[model samples]
Target: MESIFHEKQEGSLCAQHCLNNLLQGEYFSPVELSSIAHQLDEEERMRMAEGGVQTEEYRTFLQQPSGNMDDSGFFSIQVISNALGVWGLEIILFNSREYQQLRIDPIHEKAFICNYKEHWFTVRKLGQQWFNLNSLLTGPELISDTYLALFLAQLQQEGYSIFVIRGNLPDCEADQILRIMRVEQQQRPKLIGEDEAQRMSVQPVSDTPVPGDEAPLDEDEEELRKALALSRQHMEVEDEEADLRRAIQLSMQGSSDPTSPNAVVTAGSSHESGSSEETLTAEELRRRRQAYFDRQQQAHDSSTAGEVKDSGTKPNQ
Candidate 1:
């Protein structure tokens, strides 16, 4: 991890300045980080110290007690991958109009389980600038959606806005992912930006049908909201019975293609023709659904048996 922290030769002080700003920023919590830092090893600790990682800026940051956002100092932001090589988070100052971008050292490669918190956001890169939302999941734990959601919720409460990146995940897996993140996300309300607020304040002149503009319902589209709600329930069942081995196998295969849209592509006739899209057969979908329900039933049975043994609930004669 320290290998990646190799200081910028050109922006030595500027980088430090940036670090100081981030440590003092309104969107960050230094007290929380101190708790995190206490868990570091000797080598990691030395790396931070040698890098002047400990400074008055951070000290001042820690002085404030946990959970107080009002006392946070200036806005500081940096994109950093944690000590664990597998994870990365892109940090950006909320007020800064310019986007900061970073790319990996071309020679190194690994499958990053990219996730983010806050609101749904998109990513784009132009010249040296990069635009994306922030996140804080690292290493193996980074793979879980639940963890990603929790981190976002925590940051939101600290006054940092989140923008989640939605890459290609199976609908089933994606549903389970949200469940894990649901608790953390509950604390955060839907965030609106300045532009959105302005738009909201400016009410449209007419709710009645306009000449050229028809309501969205006129156009045929999937009932995404309804389907998603059902899908959410469907996915919970799948998570209980999800074959970890099969999921891993699919993940590995998905990584190899690089061009594939989803982490787990459904094999089909279109797949044989080299079409980019992935599809699942009805049979496959049904099988997964069945497996999920079966798992849930088994769990329910076990819980009932335990209740009976403990005499927590009376059994039927």
Candidate 2:
């Protein structure tokens, strides 16, 4: 499985990044996902308005850092699943709290989206191990089953929602799934909370945008479009050499700043020479530094050899 990180982007879009990784071949840019999310939010608002259901709680939920509606970063699982359907994929969602209902055996080759508090991440099982693709990490990290269970329990305790997705389906199947979701959505009741009712009784209904209305692109959307264009250009020319160069640069930067987020953390490793709360001794730190440089040299030589091999394979014009 492939893992992608949010990189320098704001934390609000971790879910968007996770989705991008999940549907890798589809190439749905973050901008496109954000647009779909915004449209879905608008649709939900319209539904609430029609049903005379005040949307204070829902609006609050959207405005939170994890689900910033204005930034087009956060999204509900239903909205995401619906958008995936539009992209020609079938999504099966499972509430994480109900472990018995989860089909872990069939998830071997599938993507799993996990939600924890205000953060969103992904994990996948390969063989007997699980790899975490949390956006905050530099790369996919190995996670133990014990850690996974504890993490899920913590999320549940925090009143956070969890969803597991099984995606990528045949076009015909996707169409059928989308139709079913639409029917279910229409039949779902829009419940009005007592607080919402009391608040709405004193205030007039807020004006809502008409369904299917097109709005001009905002600043955030414009920036996202530019980013997506640049990303496409990069993807067109990306190769192993480019990856090696990036890896080397990141390694150098991390070495130069021991306090950097990318710095290697050997806290719980069997080879850890220092305690988590203790600083490394001078000799131990030097040894680590030497080891890092040795790895960098090996990678540099390998990348150079690959480049030479590729050049030799090219036919003479």
Candidate 3:
């Protein structure tokens, strides 16, 4: 539903986004998660100091940066686990032997925190539906019950560490509303900045409205090829028509340049083979343009019919 609080990606604050989205509100901020990370770092530092202050390992660890966080605003999973603990929620490693032994289905879980590379996101069950609250997405992605397990498995395959959230999530308007009535997504949301990136590409936009579901295959490429050809065809027609019109206007103005290449004089002849060519009058040019357009239309219709036949579908029209 529209009430879902989705934070579009900004900087490397995915950990902040992940926790806040999981809690279904702006429950946590960068400062809060960073504080948690620093605390974890201090604890690790004190543990290393126990190995004796002068030890090689302790000195080497001191020289290195904090493992719990980095300059890019990334927080370790330990930080996330600790942050969730603040809400009385337990975090379980999904792939751990103890949890895997239970044979529990992922769809029944209330929430999941997924991490890949350094990006973090939440796949949470709001009311009766599950939504992928990835900060990189334009908005919350509705994941069908049947596809939830498959989606998690795909993330796991792609080297993501998935943790199960075991507790009641904070109350939110989206969860309260979706529980009463379901919402269906007609079109999936694109990734954040995806449309803008596409607009910046070098390709000129086509006049034809391409179907959104067009496959990226030979068929789609062939259609684009036709569109390019049509673009060039129209450009050629317009240029020739403009030249003829200029000659027509000049002729009516009584200052026509008869020797000009585009001028439509009363007579014309070629000496090479003693052959003759008709003067290209304005009326003749209009007739020729109509004929040219008719030929183009017939060619386009034939191409469409051939494509429909090849695709093994009945022509609906």
Candidate 4:
């Protein structure tokens, strides 16, 4: 994980992260991708001009925003394709007829780029194994060979468009070592803000609870406060919101059975947790909120500790 290059999410710049992760380096940036988008926009404008720049259609097109890029740092698939073309790599849609005809399994591919809504991510094979190199996660998630096909199927079910990366990938250390002596993961990585929730869920019974709250907080309350304050400097809220939406969706699925005994969830919070109020208890909702903040706290602490060690005031642990 340490050897693999990964860029955490910043604003809505996932397209940039997706490209770099696919190539296994800082091979792309928001500025570079934006340039690609602008070039694409220029090409499109040229085509529209062929249709006659003096026409109403061309006039309207000039007034509209760039279809290839947005103010929030989003770049369209066209921009992503162009950027990969620069690296001599190409993308093949996983669900395309041409891809289906090839009968190539997910693990057989070198890398994948997935898009759901506007968020972009990479799942690439390094060494002899597959990894979900999503920037929304705390670290690279090791994927077993047997599970790779199932994973891609699940993503498609979730409305993600998966593209297989084709061509020679630039060499990197993680791939070389893993090709020889492979490493085994004792635990899987969680979504970036999910670790604290897991820890809180399994605390010993002796852990103290926050006053006036049903969920246990113990020292977690302090951590949350620290995290909330540090967020301006250390984290982006977009990815946390995405995780929250996912958790709520899972909760809704669990509570979908109206006939089930546990189906009655509280109404207001249910809007955010999922449509079914019965899905997440108010206690669970608080815990999920805690998880979001706990993520920020961890990132902030890690950064601060690094600065301290660099100053020679603290030894590297």
Q: In model 2, what are the clashing residue pairs, if there are any?
A: none
Q: Return the top candidate by TM-score.
A: 3
Question: Candidate 4: which stretches are off by over 4 Å?
Answer: 196-317
Q: Global CA lDDT of candidate 4, please?
A: 0.69
Which rank order by TM-score, best down to worst?
3, 4, 2, 1
Q: lDDT winner among the candidates?
A: 3
| lDDT tens digits, residue span 40-64, model 4 | 9999999999999899999999999
Lowest lDDT sum, 10 consecutive residues, model 4, at 227-236
- The digit string of per-residue lDDT tens for model 1 on 189-233 reads 111132344454475877676454433431212232221122122
Instruction: Give me the overall lDDT of model 2.
Output: 0.45
Give candidate 2's TM-score: 0.39
What clash count does candidate 4 reach?
Answer: 3
Predicted structure 1: lDDT: 0.29
By summed lDDT, which 10 consecutive residues of candidate 3 come out lowest? Answer: 227-236
**How are the candidates ranked when ordered by lDDT, highest leading?**
3, 4, 2, 1
Would you list the C-alpha lDDT of every candidate in the order shown? 0.29, 0.45, 0.70, 0.69
What TM-score should be assigned to candidate 4?
Answer: 0.63
Task: Kindly give the stretch of ten consecutive residues in candidate 2 with the minimal lDDT sum.
Answer: 229-238
List the pairs of residues colliding in candidate 1: 21-76, 22-76, 25-74, 146-180, 146-181
Compute each candidate's TM-score over C-alphas. Answer: 0.25, 0.39, 0.64, 0.63
Tell me the spans in candidate 2 whose CA falls farther than 4 Å from its real position: 1-11, 45-68, 87-109, 126-129, 144-160, 169-317
